[model samples]
Target: MKKKLIFLTNIFLCILFIRFVSAAGTAGSLNINIIESQCLLDFGEGWNFFSFCRNLIDKNASNVFSSAENNYRYIMRWNQEKQEFDIFSPRSSRNPVPDLNDDESYFIYFYSNSYLDVNGTSPGDESRNLVEGWNAPSYQLGFSKTIDSLTLPIEYQYRYIMKWNLSRQEFDIFSQKSLKNPFGTIDQEEGFFIYSKEDLILNIFNMQ
Candidate 1:
């Protein structure tokens, strides 16, 4: 009887894992490590963005983007009803709290830098807002995404995709002028800096 119960428990755990991956869809798992300081970041893929924010502000007592008077983080969670990403200041009672959905993601600036040891399996997705200048971003997938897959327009006068090499802990620049293959794959959880010709929206949510 005890052996049968153990077997059933294993089965249940497997189902939960399967559900977690399926829910994340193209964005895949959220596994990241903060080896350095001084950077704004998106919730690693497959995470409930608001819950992660609350965990930092409420549970961990970490400052995300708040003043001493109002301890909290400036997190943006996608509003499906409104079809837009809205800012969330945890200290404010009027803020509409929303879940960071499986097919969406947002960015947060952490002024009070601290080491992060992230480990979990909750479903999520990826999206990045690009302004007409250098912007730091990361891909929250278990695998890499190729440049061809990104469909970057070569006609854009000023463009650059600089991917951070996690293994070497360095930056790799990709541009039309650069002889290095611009069509290489940008690996999972690899933070990058992009210089866009104009304002743009990047959606890796549908990437597979």
Candidate 2:
């Protein structure tokens, strides 16, 4: 009887492990140390449009846009909705930074894949925002791997999606996700520390 019980317990533990692994993400997992995050619409075949923004203001240690963040605005041109408005706050930086091991296990979270809102129009200093953060633009996913030791150079990222409900004037808060892209850019390192093509995002975006 005891042997049978032990066998059942082992089976249960195995099932639990499998469940956890499957819950990770649909995409093949990558070990990325995501120091920052952002959001956009996955337009398919590796083309994604900067869509609505999501800020993980909870990470007190995360990179934040300056108080002078008012000079910018994010506009999302959803094919489904007409009256477009600001997607998120420049103050609400979309890089969704999450917690990971102190070492080789940092991970990111992606909420959804559809519905895009382009990066905001900030006319000043887009370069400084590039370094202080890592690059996973939109989720709260946890670690990417398990570290047997204390700390090792870590790399991981996670992101999610957001959409608007046409019926609701206010953003959907989290609904329709329509786009898909195997290739996209990561702005996790922008607007925080390293400075380069500061407004590269705005310059590249051709929104009408």
Candidate 3:
């Protein structure tokens, strides 16, 4: 009788341990699926500097801008090699910009307050190649981070970082060597310009 009672107790404890492990695994999977589902961004009237923090199912400019078709005026992307703005207007018959890339950023003009709701997969371990001059790159994370917290290679050097001021219609600049910097944090919904002294890859890990 004593041996049988001991055996029964051991089996009960083993079953509880297995059930706990299964529950924990299911919770983790649910969290990952929720994080990768969609990204929501808000845009005010006039020019707004923006970028998508996820990889959309359709990257075409038309499909991505479908939500704000009536409110948006145009979307302009900076041409790094040509040193000009590639404009894409819904009203125009011929648009210079066709596709919206994950690594690049754009300046979008809107007539009224609107928002972009993008359903896409999460961008895992984002990285961008910076040239010797100005580069308009997007922050590919799902959360906000300060400029000082960004990790860069030892050989890479940044001269300045600038973010567009939507209300004031100006650029908020942040310099590493400057005593007074206006822009410090980088928001996930917006994009910013960075000047690099040399060519290097900017790696941003997705901590979400």
- Per-residue lDDT for 89-206 in model 3, tens only? 9988788887888888889998987767776666677788888788998776756767767744522388888888888878888887889898677876578888888888888777
Off by over 4 Å in 3: 1-36, 154-156
* Comparing 2 and 3 on TM-score, the stronger one: 3
CA lDDT of each prediction against the hidden true structure = 0.43, 0.22, 0.73
Writing each residue's lDDT as its tens digit, candidate 1 over 49-133 gives: 2122111212222233323223225665544344455776656666554343323334443344323333233224546666667
* TM per prediction: 0.42, 0.16, 0.79
Error of 1 at 5 (Å): 31
Q: Return the top candidate by lDDT.
A: 3
lDDT at position 171, candidate 3: 88
Best candidate, TM-score? 3
Candidate 1, residue 165: how far the Cα is off, in Å: 4.2
